[model samples]
Target chain A: MHKSLRSTLWILIATLGATAISIIAISRGESINALWFIIAALCVYSIAYRFYAAWIAATVLAVDSTRATPAERFDNGRDFVPTHKWIVFGHHFAAIAGPGPLVGPTLAAQFGYLPGTLWILFGAVLGGCVQDMVTLFLSTRRDAKSLGQMARDELGAIGGTAALIATFSIMIILIAVLGLVVVNAMKHSPWATFTVSATIPIAMLVGIYMRYLRPGQVLEASALGVVLLLMSVVGGRYIDEHDNLRLLFDHEGLTLAWSIMAYGFAAAILPVWLLLAPRDYLSTYMKIGTITLLAVAIILLQPNIKMPAITQFIDGSGPIFGGKLFPFVFITIACGAISGFHSLIASGTTPKLLSNERDICMIGYGGMLLESFVAIMAMIAATVLEPGVYFAINSSAGAVGSNALDAVTKISAWGYPVTVEQMENLAKQMGETTLFARTGGAPSLAVGMASIFGKAFGDGLLAIWYHFAIMFEAIFILTTLDAGTRVGRFMLQDMLGNIWPKMGETSWTPSVILTSSIVVAGWGYFLYIGVIDPNGGVNILWPLFGIANQMLAAIALCVATGILVKSNKLKHAWITAAPLTWLAIITTTAAWQKIASPDIKIGFFSAATDLADKLASGTLPAAKAAIAPQLIFNLQLDAWLTLTFVILLWIIILDMLRVCWRCVTGKPILPLTESAYKPSSLLDDWVRD
Target chain B: MIIKLKTLWKIIRQLSGDDAYEVYLKNFAKHHCNHNNTDCSTPLSKADFFKRWQDEKWQGIKRCC
Candidate 1:
């Protein structure tokens, strides 16, 4: 039997075995034993990674083994990063894997542990891993072209232009939604807010020391930064206890939004040698170390997965952001399981660092599989909480019933009942006024983790455990925030430079500041609205983010399909084309549903109409009426975003058709100019020996 | 029709290698069509023309060719 065929069969058996066991356990009303399930999952994943992943890495990927990495051939101290294959793999994995895997899966567990887990596992193997690997391979072959450029090259000029537009728009929406999640988590927690807020100065101090005093001492600087960051977390407890300090840090949501904007501007304007580089380095370390520790902790603790498989909230009315399990779970767990944004990174940054083509499997496919496991851990963390507490923490007051008393009543009416007394007791235990409407998945997951860690470490360490969880999430989220801001700033400057050449230069301080402010304000506006939203921003912003991210994936896949067809690998094109078609269908249907549905809670168009009706009937209160215009505008914006995605997808499809026609008829297609860098003869062996 | 499809597929596979397939297609088109006009003598070129073809007010032949 062929080795590839045999290995593929084993992977199927393992995956099916895991799936069958999980289904039977859930159906039989047996408690999900975390240790057993995790072991089983890891065993299966390891086999897949070792046998199947390696085979694909060697053959299907067909990496040119003879070529020497850039580090060996064109080693530059700066951007031309040269490192060992394993080190590069580690760095890439650490950079991409963040709190996304942890937070998304935990929240999506509202559907059922089985559904969320299966999606993470299956989605990673088929959709996410394939997207990442193929994008990396394509980009590497094209001299590390970006996702947008690849789309244009394979699809044609029109597809490429549309992809760029989609990318820019998606970046804005992603930053805004993520910013909202952070603000909501920190809103009422002065200790968390202060500690996280302190990281800025800590990063700057480390940044200065690295730049001026100890240049090239990344390891040393990061070590100092991590220690200081932990100290700041400890220090936050004292600040929270102090009345004056607490008052100073405890600003309202809108005020916090402004502060974040100011921080983004400052961070962007500073030289990379300063805060940005040091913070990125420290964040890189913290993200990797903390996620590993949490995973280990979960494995060692082996806590029971207590939450029911399916919640009563499956009717698009569940608390922590509305929408049923079928679509929303797929959307909520977007980045961790499969994200279009990763395609951007795969093409933009990682591909540029590829030393060997074979490494693509490890960095792309293996990295995504690791992220999926993180999501699985997040699911475990979320499900461990008592159902009543989970409901109280995740449910918005408006949706859970309306008002506290009503919320309690309605929740008690459900199978997993919670009394007012029970709610108060749980809130007191968790040290919060009302756990209701803490829409950000981070806080609830933190609280649950704290309980687990508290039990393991000792009762007295609960506070430390809580802050540790906060610091872990903050490190990842802040990394994303700053990195996103810098990327956005650069993009804006590039666009502006096209109009006024001087504005494009990175060294121009005035232009840098102007572009930075514009970029910050773009995402900041959305963050501000999300913060002020009484209905919990997750309800509105998450779906938008999900759709946008998915659309980017569709674009990426379209580009890949076009390239395959152009290369006359039509038989194999379906490997990418199939996923592309499915994503298009999913995104289009979701967008259409979002636009057409009359429910103000689900559909943007219907929501707009509902608001207008309320205004005309004079039934809305003055305060509600004031916010009505904003809601209506938001609805229209949603529609516009949907339209943009549709147009981008179609443009790419048209480009693919053109490319296919060209190839089929043996027409001359213009190829881009070649790069100067040459691959070693060793690397050429696999491709052309 | 089947033969044509098979021939087209073969041409596509050959084109995947290099631009030599373009010359072959051009010759094949000239033999079949019996036209001296460069624009009409080649199916491959016709395909390129149509792919790049735009229906707009500012369309320019120089910009394309």
Candidate 2:
């Protein structure tokens, strides 16, 4: 086909798919098929990748293929080694993806699928991908500087400090919310608890094998690790079947939360090779394989979307979490759409290994497009289950009541009718004692995945598939939990190093222990409170994580825009500035509501005040009265933190505006400091190998 | 036919990280010491090079959310 004709064909396909999707979503009083959502997403991504991404690469970044990259100019066989583009893409994608994309969309399914799906598709292409690519390009030109270093160099000291503080704060909240998810998924479920616990030993065994038995044999070690992991997944079923063994592994949410906290602390203090590295390698492979399998299964099965286009939850009466759809949906679905975390990875590792500057288009922008697709798949998975079941699984006991009958009655009154026996049967089939209030989004997603896989693969394997999905999600979440804690410790040491010079040394024993303890406690306190909260921890922790993450993204975009202005690329400044302005609005509104709204359910301060009023009036029940003070304190603390995030965002935004003003007024702020231009002499194509 | 199958196997091994040391040795010989040898065989032993690479790769802020 001719080139223009090919473009025309693609445009036609995209238009058709979009039209079909909007019609399905908007049509009232009828159920829609999941296949339309998948088709719509795939078509839109194809068009976006081919056209919008191409335009950005050519016009905005002006990628020059002949220019020598830092990886080529400073090829030292260590950090600056030039790598194959696909390998770099894989590594970058693995680093950025976590349980965030999967869980966020699952939770946001409360407003149905239309709003979340649309935001994910538009957000990644316009906001997330642009931030990542521009940041990667800017950092690469400066010899692969990290985000914080770039902020300090391009903006000023204040911007740099705010960026560093945002990174540290986001890391703590990210870990806490992730830990809560794992805790909720494992609570009182012997099958999931046993399977997840088995991964630690499997990783340690693989680590020792790689270190002592067969050094550098990563493939062999990870292969063995994967096989053993599968065996453990199967073995967990038998363990759950055995009455005595099940009793040994079964525990409540609070106990599991404590165990996870201890695990995070120990994993941080221990050597990387022992548990963190090995587990990371295993999970990377599993992550890719599982996501690929899910995409395939969804396409093959084409399950119908049971949830409506819009639900009553859009009004902010959502049982899963509070806040209306406008800003909350964008906040809820961060990772899949435009996660700020990817900016760190883009500026951190991907730029260092870029053999050719052109590969930036693929690694930075394309990698995020794939993550958005994962979020779309998560939406599909959440909506595939009966709406009643999704609500029953995701809503907390406090919202829907504790028992199965009460849950059924409450959910039915809300419009979606489900029977107690039906819930029990589904739980028994999935090999769980009860799935009434799983609360964390993991179990509901697993149920969705299991149904899709079971329908596509075979019958009587729902339990196996369900356990496998749980293990898959748990592996990645645990990987993030341990890795985030370690990063947090390093950042803490760097901060404390200013006061006590000796504390900066990473290898010092007391410094390591002290920093690790502080880092663990920072997130651990939130995880403990979340586990004890009657409404489920995700309702509190997830929004905090989203706000913190978007704040970091705002900082990253500010740095990008500042760099562009300094470099005299004023014409293309809108590429970064537009997203930065929109994110500032969304995050500011969400933070303001969280801090000062009068609604107890949505606002942190209001919730605290309401609880206090109840206690003072002696209207609280005896059981609730005991923990009311703590809950109030937590709410108040969360309100303050939200305010802090908003303040940091404004500080960085103002710093960026200062740089822009200096550029516009010709005040000669500072000259651009890109690395000396070097021409590539290598005759070999990095990709041809 | 057999050669094609063997080539496929080699590519799979390379992608799955089985041939990392060999690739590293080639790159090291070509770029690290300024030899620019086409064959790119390095003086450092395979085990030593692999150990060094692992240590440097695992160091700071490697994962994200």
Candidate 3:
């Protein structure tokens, strides 16, 4: 058989085999036995990676075999990042696939493992992978233009501008929400907080060393940083034991918010060489190593997926966030399964690094598949926990089916029964005051992971194991935050410069600082809100973030569809167009529901109106009344967000129409560039031979 | 906003009556400006102004006005 055919067959066998096994296993009333399901998933994923991904990496990506990458092609000692493809792949994967896959899947698991798992598989294969691959291909063909530019070139100026605006807005919401997750995880855990806090100086030192002492020695510097970070994790436990240090670590939410803002500002202002670069390197290493360990651990442990395939919480009354499975599943598993953010990465960085046209399959399609697996593992981790504990950990006090007794009663009613004593005992084990409404999925996942790892590594290492999990989660999230900030700043400066040209100059220090502050402030405001919300902030913010992120994917897919149509590949365009259409429908409907629905429990706009009614009625008690106005304001804020997404979607649709018209009329599209491959003479020679 | 609208209407009527839109815009500034002093007149003729307004100037005016 031909190489391509063989590779394709291998992929189909692996993927279809896994699908068949999962279906059979679940159908056989063995929903708890996840071992076969996991093995099937891994085997299929491995085959996909080795053959399908390799095909994409070689043929579909179409990386330039002749010229070295920008890092090699134009080695200006800055920004032309040239690293080995595998290493770069690892870096990209680490950067893009962070706590998102973990948190999203865990939260979505409330609907049952099946809904989340199916979404991860179907969404990645049809939607996420296509978005990443096409964006990468387009950007590579256009000298690695950013997603915003691709939108403009293919869609039009309106589309491009809207994409940029949407991207900037999404970044703020994303970082802020992720920050809230961290804050929640560390809220009362002095040891975890202190340990994560110490990573800053360590990142800085590594940055300084890399820049001034051993330039280009990223591997060595990162290795050293990792060792130091691990030591800090160990040391943090000691500090938490000390009374004075514990007090410092136990800073209030307000204090933590301010600290995070300060940190974001400082990190933004600092040179890339100091904090961002080194942290990215370490994060890259930790992200890859830890996820691999988690995957291996899950398979070896063969833990049962105790959670059912579907739950009664499909209504917008889920414990983690109030939303049904249909829209919420797509929203919760945003990045792990499909993320708009990945489009930016595909267009911004990965495209320029393509070594051959074929590399697209691996970098674009395969990278996303890997992220989906991470989401799968996250589902496993969250579901494997005792059902009552899962509910106790995720449910906020406001939505915990009312009060503690009610909460326990309701959770116990759901397949996993538990008593108040059990909840308290588990909380004690995890070293927290209350596990209820601790809605950052990471800590619960950590607790779940620790349960498994503790059994395997022995119970004595539980605390260390717990902290290790914290560090892993922090590294993934923090890298995203820092990198996201930098990208946001650049985008802000770009927009500012368009309005007033001088602000665009990278060297204009004051302007740069001002723009950076504005960008940081945008996301910072959301983070502050999340930190302050009495209910777990993820409930509101994650869905909003998910909407924004998916909207970006919609935009990207529209652009790709346009290009494919222009190339007279309409039949093939559905590969991207179908998913694009689905996302557009999903996002548009969800956004409308969020804005129009009158239920305070679901509709952001309606919630605001309800809050106002409460404030007007004078029914709010004196102590709680002060927060009423803020709640009202947040609801209105959410309405505006929904409106923004609606507008962005229309812009992309208009752009797509324009591109389609141009293609029909044979008008030259903007940003038109030549393909990288010239039907290589070497291939011809090989054919002849 | 009113002035621009009136000017646009006048130009449209004149063009529909005789000259084309572009030609009317070209000749309007030279013949029909309130100042009638060539030096005081802006370089943008009626047609040029309409085009510019449609693309860029109108958005600014609409935003502010």
Candidate 4:
């Protein structure tokens, strides 16, 4: 076909597809099929990746095919050797993706699928992919320097320090909320508990096999690991049936929370090669395989979405988590739309492995596009459940009384009618005793995934499929927990080393254990409080995680925009500045509301005051009054943290603006810190030999 | 079709690090020598190269959420 004709064909298809999506999104009076969402997201992604991404690559970043990347120029056989672009794409995708994209969208489905779905589709095109690509480009030019170094070199010390603090804060909250999700998922469910616990031994076995038995045979070890992992999922079913085994594995939320904390601490102190690395290998393959299966199942099953496009919960009265649709949805769906975390991965390892500068578009923008698709799948999975069931699973016992009957009545009052019998029956079918108050997004997402898998594969295997999905989600979450704790420990050591240099020696046994304990304790406290909170811990921790994640993203954009302005590309600075400005507005509003809103459900201060008032008036029951003081304290602590985040966000934004001012005023601005240009003999089309 | 399948297999192997030693050797041959000299120094053995590669790849903030 002629080039123009091919272009015309793509344009036509994109237009038709987008139009179809808009129609589906707006036609909320009638139920829409899940397949419509799949088609719409896929079409929109194709158009955005092909057209918008191409324009940005050519016009904004001017990604040159001829430019030799750091990998090619540095050419160290270990870290910087040139490799295939697809390999870098896969590696980057695996690193940047985790439970965030999967869980965030599932959580945001509370306001109905429309809000989260639209944001994810358009947000990735305009915000997420742009951040990843621009950061990748900037880091590649600067010899694959980390985000912190780039922030300092470009935006000066204030921005650098702010970015560093934000990264550490985000890591703590990220791990805490993730741990909370795992605890909630496993709480009082023998099958889930057994399956998740089985992964640790399986990972250890794989670790030993790779280390002592086969040594560097990753594929072989991973193959064995995957088989054992599947067996564990099956073994969980048997354990669930065995009276003694069920008693051993089944535990309430608090006990499970402590167990997770202990596991994280142990995982952090252990050698990476023994536990973390092997689990990572198995999880990567699992992640890829599961995501693939989900995409295929969504297409094949094409189930109708039971939830409406717009729900009344958009008015800040959502039972899942509170906040109006504006900032809450954006923050809740961070990883799918635009995660600040990806900027870290973009600058950390992906830039170091880029074989050619041109591959940045595919590896950066394209990788995020794929992750966003995963988020879309999660959204589909969540919305496919009846709205009554979704709310019953996600809402806490505190919100809708403790009994299943109370949950049904409350949910039905909101217009989506469900019954206790229906809930019990579904739970039985899925091989669980109860699914009420799963609270975290993981179990509901697993329910969603299992539905698709069971419907597509075999109906009789719903229980197995559900456990399998739970295992997949839990594996990734645990991977993040272990890795996040290690990273947080290192960051703490770096800070503590300022006071005591000996503490920073990563190899020192005392230093390792001390820092690991402190880091685990920091997040473990939040996890403990969350586990004990009457209104599920997700409500308190997830928003904090979202806000902190977005704050880091805002800092990343600041660094990117600063680099652009310093290079005299002032006109092109809007590419990064646009997202930065929106993030600044949204994060500030979310933080302010979280701290000051009068609604007890939404605001930390108000909740604290309300609890105290209730206690003083002697209106609360003894059980509630006993926990009121601690609840008030937790709320007050959250308010202070929100204020701190707000302050950190402004500090970096003001620093970035100051740099922009200098550039505009013709004052001597900081010089660009990119490496000196060197000509290369490598062809742009060079492939791995 | 068989040829295409073989090519696909090779590509997958190359990307997934199944062929890491082979790729590293090729990279070494391509870039090791300075001043246009060929084979100026022998590259590390495959076992040594693989160990170093694995270590470098896993260090320092490799996972994200």
Candidate 5:
């Protein structure tokens, strides 16, 4: 009774606090303290993790503590070694946390804080966390199957094929959008470009150090890499100050785009240990350290969120991306909320390392909850910037003319007023010539982070803090870019092998170069188009990436729901089914709008038609007319891609439903595929104790 | 003081994957010591094992968004 009382009191306090905080956060207000977002996220995560996640782990999945995991059964010293639960959690978190959580929330803040914050908090607890934990548990039970293989086995051929196509397309768009972000961040900024450029040689140096001097010393090498990386962040300022040095590093968007493509290609085909491995190691350390510092700094600073609780952009006239708040916020902020990408990592990547089935809830659900908090922090970071500055940095010359004065006038007319002098002052303070029309979320987020960090640590070193944040984000984006390119190469090879078997040979140099080029070309085309886009490439690429990501999540949920039905747990399938239903509704809605809406700004097909008509009638503006034909083609291509995503999404969902219906009707369906249980020895030790 | 510091240092090594080879050998010995027979397959060398590990880790969808 005493324990029950304590528990009840705990629930009551958290519930009341969560309700009170959310109400204040959402109610019509301006300049709400950013601290409210932090409190609200914490309250929601703790409650959901404790109750909903625990119930799913205990009742729905029936995770048996005594059941031996695959790691215990197949203790290969390489992949399947049993690990401490906390260590597994950390590794899992590191693998899943990327620029997605950081960049998505930063972009979604264009709609203001309320929508993104609520979505991140509620979406993760109910949708993303459940999806991840259930997928991890089910995959562990099935011998750590890949997402594609699980779909093939449980949901049949159509579902499996859809999953494969979704993953490949997601990779392409994800890499391209990330490349666009990097290009936008580094373009014309010598400090960021130089710091980012320095990372390659720095990583290689550490790789050689680890390989030759102290074999297998990852910690030592990464420490050396981190120290060197920090120095470059400082070194960038020196380069920026020197005119000749600055000219060498500074480049346009198109040049940076090509350079990034070259870097991605090289990283893909080059030996992994040299660049990819060492960079991954070094970046993971920096990711953890920098994210922790940002968290502490946010708490210490208690900065006010300058953006309103809801913006006029909610109706879909925002310069960042063109979409309504309802589904667009959900679509834009998939990673922190219900990212489909986590399902890929959750299934085969970390499941095999678990020693106990019970650890799935913590490692999967808890890890995502932490990522959601990071998303909340990002939203706070972006929102803390003056709304006028946010728009100035995220807008494109296409929306707000090419010059700073014209851009200021256009943005000021939007009710979020700014001046040319204010923009110039900010740029000068941050050690840049101009922050206008930066477009991608990276530069703005860096400005926000630098502001918070400068106030919290030392107000004197704003430029260094700003560059550090940029380097931190660049490291993440570039890491994802190369790793994704390599993975895409393998997938393409795996498919191409069906036509010509020799193309699948990974070690064959000809096959390697051929497949790598194909994958690079796939994203490089999109990246190049994005750079030339006057309205800012982010407006085009980010939504498409978001849709692709959510579609992948939809595929993952379909697989999870199908497995649950096969397991004869169709009644409790709502845990996966609800989120699956939400994703299906959201992605299809967003895709439909993108493809069919008459508004040229919101609809891909409409935009293409408008541009084609303009070109035909000779009414196109001078700058636009030059790029008119290509723009029309790209718009149509994007429309077709959106249509394809929707079609694939429905196919998978319908197949899952069909299998589910067959199960409910007592028809013959695939039997549940859990591995035979082996009682763990750890249970015996507990009994002895 | 030294013991605490040593424990922390070991953890850093483990987390950064620096101690993978040592951990692999220890686990292998624990799994095989009871057999005392040649049927126990020889474990991979440190260099070969690291190579195998990198190939697998870098392949597939290793990282997320």
Candidate 6:
């Protein structure tokens, strides 16, 4: 009784503190400090982890610490190791932490910081963390089934196929959007282009060292790679100082787009030991190191949030991306909050490494909490910039204007005053030709990161810091681009193998090249149009990516809820059902809006129609007219894609609901047997460091 | 203090997969001794181990966006 009372008191205190900080964050103060965002997020995460997640593990799932997991049962000593919880946590976090959280929050900051901040907190605690933890628990219970297998077993064929197709489509859209981000960051900027290009040779050298020079020496090769990467950052400045070398490295969007597509194709077909493995190591290390550095710098520096609590863009005229703050903010910041993609990681290799079933709460729920915190830091970084400058960097030329002065005038007229001189000085400070209309969130994030690092460390190396940030983001984004392409190739081959056995052989050169090109071309077409789109392709692609990602989350939740209802624990089914319901509402509404909204800025079909009319009437300029037909086709294609996603989403949700109804009404359903799950365990013995 | 730092480094190596081959060898030998079995087949070489590890690791949906 005494222990229970004390725990209750602790929970009460945590709740009260979190509420106060959140209120302060929500209220419009003169200028809120960035530290408040950090504090609020920490308070909410701890409270959720302690009370909510622990309850779910104990009561909802009754996770048995003594129950031997697949890792312990199988004991392969290779892929299935019964690892400690902290090690598992690190691996899981690294797997899920990508450009999604950083770029999503930065783009959503256009609606001001509050909407994104609240969603990142609320969405992760109630939705994202729950989905990850439950999916991890379910997968662990079933000898570590992948998500598609779980869906197929629990919900039937329609749900399984929908889940698989959603995962594949989102992978394509995710890579195309991320590729656009890298292109925008590297285009027309000699320093950034030089630094990013240096990573290829750097990765290849590390690959050769790992493969032949000193086999199994990952740590040493990665350390050497880090040194070379930093040297290239410094060397980029040298190249930038030399006009001819700078010109050679500098290229426009079209050139970078083709280069990235070719790189993806090469990575997909090349042996994993050569390029992908070495690149993954370097990116994982850099991602962890840079995120840690950013967190510490933000704490030490404590920059003030310069944007308002809510901006006029809340009503839907945001410069960065279109659509109202209602469904769009939720869509724009998908990963940092309740990303559907985390479900994939939760159900993937992470589950197969679990030693104790009870560790699922920490490795899954707690891991997602940390990822959400990274999103909070990204939000702080973006909002800490001057609002006018943020708009100037992220807005498209089609939205703002063709030149720096006009962009500044237009942004200033919206009540956030900026000048051409200020932007020019910032560009020079960052070693760039221009900063206006970078438009894909990478350049602005680099600037924000540079400013923070410059203030916290020293102001002397702002230009180098800027390029370092760019290089880091590009490295993370490019690794995802290639790894995703390779995975998509395997997925396509698997699907096609069902039809033609010859096509299924992953080692055949003909099969490899065919699938690799098809996968590359799948995303490359989107990347190509995104490169040439004058209205800023991210404006369309990011939302589509968000919708598709959320659809996957919905499918994962359906499977979890179906299992809950089938296990006769219908009372606890709301834990997954609530998030599934919310995702369904958001994805369905967002898809409908993208398809049918009358506003040309928000809807794909409307944009296509608007452009087609302009083309017919000869109102478009010669340059716009030349690209008008392709843009129209692309927009209509996006609309059709969104419609398909909506249909697939409903089919999965309704099918799962049908399965649950059958179980509820005593009808026969797919039986989950005791051989798949057994209960035994105590939790106290497993917390050792 | 030195021991503690060593332990921390070991943990980092474990998590980053820097020490994967070492762990695999230890586990392989231990499993060979399990159940009084006397198979005594050679474990994979360092080069082959790394190659197989990469092939298996990338075969599934590993990374996220």
lDDT of 6: 0.89
- Scored against the true structure, residue A69 in model 6 reaches a CA lDDT of 80
Model-by-model lDDT, in order?
A: 0.69, 0.88, 0.71, 0.88, 0.88, 0.89
What lDDT score is found at residue A168 in candidate 2?
Answer: 94
lDDT of 1 by residue, A598-669 (tens): 667778788788888899899987877888788778778877777777767777776777777787788877
- Candidate 5 chain A minimal-lDDT segment of 10 residues: A680-689
Residue A614 error, candidate 5, Å: 1.7
Where does model 2 exceed 4 Å of error?
B1-16, B31-44
Model 4: what TM-score? 0.97
Q: Single out the weakest 10-residue window by summed lDDT for candidate 2 chain A.
A: A680-689
Residue A5 displacement in candidate 1 (angstroms): 16
Off by over 4 Å in 3: A1-31, A43-84, A213-215, A401-406, A665-671, A675-689, B1-65
Q: How well does candidate 3 score on lDDT at residue A90?
A: 53
Question: Candidate 6, residue A91: CA error in Å?
Answer: 0.5
Q: Native contacts recovered by candidate 4, as a share?
A: 0.52
C-alpha positional error of residue A212 in candidate 5 after TM-score superposition, expressed in Å: 2.4
Candidate that scores best on DockQ: 6
Cα RMSD (Å) per model? 14.2, 2.3, 16.4, 2.2, 2.3, 2.2
Candidate 4 deviant stretches above 4 angstroms: A684-689, B29-50
- lDDT per residue for candidate 4 within A1-689, as digits (tens), equals 99999999898878878776887678866778887787788788888888888888898878777777788787765677677788889899999999999999999998988989999988888889999999999999999999998998888889889999999999999999999998988988999999899899989998888667776677788889999999999999999999898999989888898899999999998988788988998899999999999988988888888888889999999988999998899989899999999989999688777878878899989999999999999999998999999999999999898988989999999999899998998899889989999988999999999989999998899999999999999998999999899988888888889999999888799999999999999899899889888899898899999999999889889998888887778888888899889999999999999999999889999999999999999999898888888888999999999999999999999999999899889888768888877765567346644
**Candidate 6 segments whose C-alpha is farther than 4 A from its true place:** A1-16, A19-26, A677-689, B33-39
- CAPRI level of candidate 4: acceptable
lDDT of 6 at A304: 91
Poorest stretch of ten by lDDT in candidate 4 chain A? A680-689
Model 2, A1-689: lDDT tens per residue? 99999988987988887786787668676777777877787787778888888898898778888888888877766567677777788878888888889999999999988899899988998999888888888888889989998888878789989989999999999999988988888989999999999999999999898777887788889999999999999999999999899998999888998899899999999988898989999999899999999999988888888888789999999999999997999999999988888888988688877888888888888889889889999999999889999999999998999888988999999999899998899999999988988988999999999999999998689999999999999999999999899989989999999999999999899999999999999999999889888999799999999999999999999999888878778898899999999999999999999998898889998899889999999998898899889899999999999999999999999988988998899886756768887887653764436
Tens digits of per-residue lDDT for model 3, A1-689: 99999888777777776765667346633556666556655665666567555554455443555533333333221233233345446545654677788888888878877778778776787688778877877776676677777777766788888888878788888888888878878877888888889889989888777555764344566678999999988888788778897888987766877788788888777766677766766776677777788777776777777777677888777777776667778877887777887887787666544444445666677778888888878888898887778888887766665367888887787667878888777767755556676777888898888877776667777777778888888876876777677767777777788899998886699987897788788888888777666666788898898899888888888878887777676656677778888888788877887888776777987777776888899987775478778777887888888888888787787779777878778887764443443332222221112
